[model samples]
Target: MKIVITGAGGQLGKELLQLFKEEGYMVFPYTKQQLDITNRAKIKEMIEKIQPDYLINTAAFTQVDLCESDIDKAYLINGIGPYYLACEAKEKKVKFFHISTDYVFDGEKIEPYMEDDSPNPKTIYGKSKQLGEALVLDAYESSTIIRTSWLYGHEGKNFVNTIKKLARHSLEMRVVHDQYGCPTYTKDLGIALKDLLTKPHGIYHVTNSGSCSWFEFATEIVTFLKSQTVVIPVSTEEYGLKTPRPMYSVLSQKKLNSNGVSLRNWKEGLHEYLKKEDDENGH
Candidate 1:
């Protein structure tokens, strides 16, 4: 299987690229600098040249707060970019996979969100991502859209790394406890993505099993590392985030399970991730 992946420099993109390469598939990776998805001409030219079996887009303006200030950039990258890519992929008859976020839904639901859940985005980032999903599906009905939450990977700036850094520097860290979501490891998600290759094309919610607040997530990391940092739980209001996030963004895994694909629990994924960090650092 030949796959062309955009945002190859990102945590998820990097993990996917490595996974595909290790699986012995012909993989082509493009960073945002190399292949701007917003540029329709460039996207068309590249898709024609690669003729990939699958085109996975992990590119997006993911900064939740910054997205609010940069509305145009957010819409262009997070919304229109996927649409442009989907159009090109459709033209070439290439199977397209676009990564989406849990932010698409409002935090109104207390239960896990299914694939069919209606999105009522509360922030610019969420609104932009929701638009991207709609546009992609509208452009190509056969497109596969994967919605994930609280993703972390070894290759880039993610919550895990951020927490680790904070633990090392600060004695106490305040994390928002009110916001809840599944913490997904990019590597695990990459493996699941491979399994979805032969399945039906549609939106799939893929995340590590179980959910936790940001405080709990950070506490896990500190405990694993045996750090002295005190993790204090804070509410969303106390955290004073400039942008609002879905307080309950746990996406359901029923669709993925029905398709014979499920990832390990968040704690397990995080433990392995930290172990890898330890190994790399010669701890």
Candidate 2:
């Protein structure tokens, strides 16, 4: 089967490319230079050329703070881009798989968020993603929207890499303890997406089981690296930012479970990611 992945240079897109290649599928991974998703004409041109059976969109304007300041760019990339891709995919009779985020929720619920939960985004980034999800679902009934959270991998500028860098260079670090969510390894998510492609389509929450605060995640990184860096736990007020992050964005995997596909715990996935990074960098 022919598969097309947008944001080919991003961490998740790269992992998907690797997984698809290993699975012996004809995969066309397109970076921003190859095909700009925000441009509807370009998106149509590329999809027409590839004529893929599935279009897995991993592209987005992910800078949360930047999105708060630059709402236009955020909507263009995160909202309109996915809308255009879904329309083209529907016209071509291809299954569209659009990756979304847990930020779609307002973080008010104490329990894990189920798929049927109504979204009340508190940030511009979250609002944009919610718009994207709505557009894709409205345009294509066969589309699969996977809402994930705290994504990281061996490659990319993510929380794990940031913590690792700080541990390597600084004597101490302050991380937010109030905000909580599941940390998803991109490679595992990539494999999960590949598996989901073969199954029935619908909305699914695919993240590694379990949740943790940024402080806890940072502590784990320091422990794994055997670093002496002291990770200080701080509340959200102490680490105040322009964008208001979800205090609890833990997604329930009951939907993926119902589909008979769920990933392992976040810590286990983190261990494998760290090991892979160490091996690749000759650590």
Candidate 3:
């Protein structure tokens, strides 16, 4: 099978690229520098030339706060990019898989969000992603959209890296305890994506099982590292982020489970990630 992965520089994209290659698939990884999805002419040119079986789009303007300031750039990349890919993929009859976020929905529901849940985004990033999801599906109903949350991986700057960086500088740190979501590991999500290829194409909520607040997640990271960094829990008001966020964006994996695919719990994924870091560092 031939696969084309955009946003190859990202955490999830890098993981998918490595996993696909290890499984012996003919995979072409393209970073933003190589293939800007917003460029429609370039997208068509590349897709026609490669004739890939699958095009996985992981490229996105994920900086939540920055999205508020850069609305046009965010919509251009996050909203319109997938539309271009879907149009080209549909014409070429290639399977298009788009990655999305839990932020698509407002934190109105206390229970976990299902795939069919109504999306009322609270931020520019969420709105743009929601737009992207719609554009992809409208262009090609056969396209697959996977909504994930709180992702961390070895290859990129994520919450894990941020906390570790802060830990190195300060003995104490404050994390918001009110916000809640599933923390997904890119390696595990990549495996889930591979499994998804066997199932029907549509929207699916895929993430590590279970959920926790940022404060709890930070504590777990520190505990795993055996670091003396003190984590202080604070409310969202105290954190005072300029951009509004979904307070409870935990997505249910019932769709994935019904498809006979489910990821491990968040804690197990985190443990493996830390272990991988240790191995890489020769610890």
Candidate 4:
């Protein structure tokens, strides 16, 4: 089967590419320079040329604060981009897999969000992703929209790498303790995505099994690295960001569980990710 992955240079996309290559599948990985998803003509042309059985879209304007400031760019990349991809995929009779986020919820609910829960996005980024989800589902009945949270990987600028970088240079690092979500390892998620391709198509939530605050995640990183940096916990107010984050963005894997696919616990996934990084760097 021929599979096309957008955002090929991204962490998740790179992981997916590796997994697909290992499986001996014919994969076409396209970076932003190769194919602009926001350009409908380019998207249509790529879909026509690739003739893929699956088009997994990982492209997006992901900076939450930047999205808040540049609403047009956010919508263009996250919303209209996916819409065009879905449209092209529909026309080509290919299965569409669009990655979404847990930020679609307003964080008012304390429990892990189910797939059927109503989305009340509180930021421009969340709203744009929500819009993208709607477009994907509406445009293609065969599409699978996977909503994940707190994604980090070895290849990209994510929370884990940021913490690791800071730990190497800083004596003390203050992390927000109040904001809570699952820390999804991109490689694990990449494996999950490959598994999901064999399952029935629909909306699924794929994240590490458990949830934790940023502070807890940071503490684990410091502890694992045996770094001298002290990870101090602080509230979101103390950390003060331009974008309002979801206080609780834990996503339930009930849907994936029903499909007979499950992810390991967050801590276990984290350990594997860190170990992989260490191994790669000859630590």
Candidate 5:
């Protein structure tokens, strides 16, 4: 099996690239510098040449705050980029998979969001990603769109690493207790993605089981690392993020479950991630 992964430098993309390669699959990875998805000509040329069996796009404008200021760049990269890839994949009959976020839905629902739930994005980042999901599916009906939330991995900047860094110095840190979402480890998500290859193709909510608020997530990190830092809980208003985030974007795993796939709980995934970090650092 041959797979092409975009945004290879990203946390999830890097995890997937390594996972696939280690599993004995022929994997081709491209960073933004190597293959800018915004360039349609490049996408077409590459797809035509490789004719890969699967093209997974993890490239996205993920900085929520920056997306508000750089609207054009956000839309171009998050929206049109996936569309261009979908079009090229369609032409070459390549199976397409695009990574998306929980931000697509507003925090209106108190319960977990289903895959079929309508998206009512509240931020520029969410809106742009929503557009990407729509465009990819519209261009190619057989494409898969995996929606995840609160993703963290060893390879990139994420909440887990940030908390670890701050805990090393800060005695206490404030985290929002109101906003809720599933904390997914990129390594676990990558394993699930590989499982999805033989399953049906469509929008699926893939994340570690269970959910928690930012404060709880941070607390978990500190506890796992045996840090003395205190994770103070605060409301979203007190946190004062420049860009608003979904207050409750926990995604349902029903679809993934029905498809015969399920990930481990968030805490378990986090423990493994921290252990991996320790091993890498020679701790």
Candidate 6:
């Protein structure tokens, strides 16, 4: 299958690109510099040239705090960009796959969020992403939307990398405890995406099974590395984020499970990541 992946420079996008290439599929990757999805003319031009069977858009203005101050840029890139891709992909008869986030919901629910849950975004970043999901579906009914949470990948800046770095230099680290979500590995999510290639096209919640607070995730990280750094749990107010975020955004993977694909636990994903890092570093 021929696939065109936008946001190739991103963590998840890079993983998807590598996975597809290894599977012997014809893949075209575009970094934000190469393809600005909001530019309708350019998006159309490039997509026409590729004529891909599927267009997977991972591009978004994901800086949560920055998005608060730059609402226009957030909506333009995260909301309108997917709309443009959907419009063009529809004309080409190519299936559109969009990566969404758990932030779409308010995180008020104590249980894991399902695909059909009503979205009440709490921040500009969440609103923009929620808008994108609606726009893509409205533009093309056949489009597939996958919502994930707490993503960390090898190719880009993520919680895993940041924590690993901090553990080495800092004597102690403080992480928020009230907020909870699944820590998804890009490699695992990439494999899940490959399985969804021929499945029904609609919104699906995909994440590594189980959930934890940022404090727990950080503690796990240090434990895996045998670091002496201390991990302290703090409340959201104590953490002092510039933007409002969900306190509990764990997503339900029931939809993905019903589709006959299941991701392993988040701990397993983290273990695999550390193993890969060890191998790469010749440890």
- Candidate 6 residue spans exceeding 4 A from truth: none
TM-score for each of the candidates: 0.99, 0.98, 0.99, 0.98, 0.99, 0.99
**Model 4 per-residue lDDT tens digits across residues 1-283:** 9999999988898889988999989999999999889989998888888899999999989999999889999999999999999999999899899999999999988999999999999999999999999988888878999999999987799999999999899999999999899999998898899999888888899998999999999999989999999999988998997789999999999889888899999999999899989999998
lDDT of 5 by residue, 1-283 (tens): 8899999999988999999999999999999999999999999999888879999999998999999999999999999999999999999999999999999999889999999999999999999999999999999999999999999988789999999999898999999999999999999999999999889899999999999999999999998888999888999888788999998999999989988999999999999999999999999
Cα RMSD to native, each candidate? 0.8, 0.9, 0.8, 0.9, 0.7, 0.8
> How do the residues 123-160 of candidate 1 rate in per-residue lDDT, one tens digit apiece?
99999999999999999999999999999999688889
lDDT of each residue in 79-133, candidate 2, tens digit only: 9999999999999999899999999999989889999999999999999999999
Q: Is candidate 2 or candidate 3 better by lDDT?
A: 3
Candidate 3, TM-score vs. the true structure?
A: 0.99
lDDT of each: 0.94, 0.92, 0.94, 0.93, 0.94, 0.94
Cα lDDT for residue 223, model 4?
93
- Per-residue error for 77 in candidate 5, Å, reads 0.5
Which residue pairs in candidate 6 collide? none
**What lDDT does model 1 reach?**
0.94
**Clash count for each candidate, listed in order shown:** 0, 0, 0, 0, 0, 0
